[model samples]
Target: MDTHPLFIIIDDVHPILITELEKSGITCHYHPQITRNELLTIIHQYTGLVVRSKTPIDRELIDAASNLKIIGRYGAGMENIDTDYAESKGIVCLNAPEGNRNAVAEHTIGLLFALLNKICIANHQIKNGIWDRNNNWGQEITGKTIGIIGYGNTGSTFAKKLQGFDVTLLAYDKYKSGFGNEFVRETDMETIFAEADILSLHIPLTTETNNLVNRNFIEQFQKPFILLNTSRGQIVNTSDLVAAI
Candidate 1:
């Protein structure tokens, strides 16, 4: 069997992966606390690099990785890795979003429900002995218009989770077409902004999507809507969101 060296950085991935890699003659090293400078100093020794967003594999790091043939990201999103540059250098960039897509989708719904029902707020108040039911009146999920931006794995899974909710689902993916199903209505941004009562973001962080949800984007909505983000934090400008809220 051919031997391949792999360096693991900042991932709590299951042990099975390491076992499988070793079975395939791949040397695995788990180093969760490796700094960027240390990675640059020793990256050239490995053929594969496994990371989970703690270190940015920039051009300088890539240049330092003389033997790197592949970059395996533990989860979705390759923004932390300079994919274009790596690809230009013939390095294969890989990620496993399917591993946790369901978890993310389900968590998104959990958060949405929590916000609508004021679960966190109520829990805090109840624990403090303030029984204020009137101030905690909740909103209903049924019959609400939900606009989902970026209808990819998490987005479609979220729509699936809303199957029995009786809410109108609107999905807009700028880079996708013909992906809508019975649970989701493929629509334009204008329609989503004009009609949605709830907005959920599931887009990745990229040059085009960074700070995509800004003041102007929020103001485009015809009515005030509850915002839910289960994607990269950078996608929504925090200051802009604060102002909008």
Candidate 2:
């Protein structure tokens, strides 16, 4: 068994995952929860690090990790990881999306349905003893155009999950092309805004994508559209969403 301690920092990981990794003969320094100051203090000691969304992995942490070999992410989206610097120093950064692909995809669809149906509003009204069923009739997702902004693992999974819904799934990936899948019909932003009735954002938040959903895009949308932003909060501008919603 490999007994050498692979000094590590795993944030936002469940207890079960730590136990499994430890059982595999790798010694893990489990700081299950930590603050920035505490992290800076303890991070230099670890050679391996695992992370989720709770902590930000910046250049300071990477520079301090002299013995660091790899950084493992429990979910998809390596947006927080400093990939260019890691590659410059030969550190392996990995994300395990295969574990929760179906979960995120299902959750996205569920959120869309809830939004369109006003599920929370319906539940609240019923509890308050208001029983006008006609007032709460919801819009159907069938045959509507859905614009999917990103086409990564989650985006692709979301596309596959939408097959049964019978809606037109139009997708655009900034870095990807030739998305000729049967489940999703590939298109450009102009076409999406002109035609989509429901726009589901699946893009990552980077400098380019920050506030990608802005007033301009909102104004361009020809339909009284429903928006979905389960991927990243910043991808959809908070101010724009507030204004539109």
What is the alpha-carbon lDDT of model 1 when measured against the actual structure?
Answer: 0.90
* lDDT per residue as tens, model 1, 49-160: 9888778889999999988899999889889999999999999999987777899999999999999999999999999999999999999999999999988888888899
What TM-score does each of the candidates earn?
0.95, 0.89
User: Candidate 2, residues 64-133: lDDT per residue as tens digits?
Assistant: 7777888898787778888789867878888886677688889989988887888878999999998878
Off by over 4 Å in 2: 1-5, 19-25
**Candidate 1: stretches off by over 4 Å:** 5-10
Please, what is the whole-model Cα lDDT of each candidate in the order they appear? 0.90, 0.81
In model 1, what lDDT does residue 31 have?
Answer: 78
Q: Pick the candidate with the highest lDDT.
A: 1
Model 2 worst lDDT window (10 residues): 1-10
Error of 1 at 115 (Å): 0.9
Top candidate on TM-score is 1
In candidate 1, list every pair of residues with a backbone clash. Answer: none
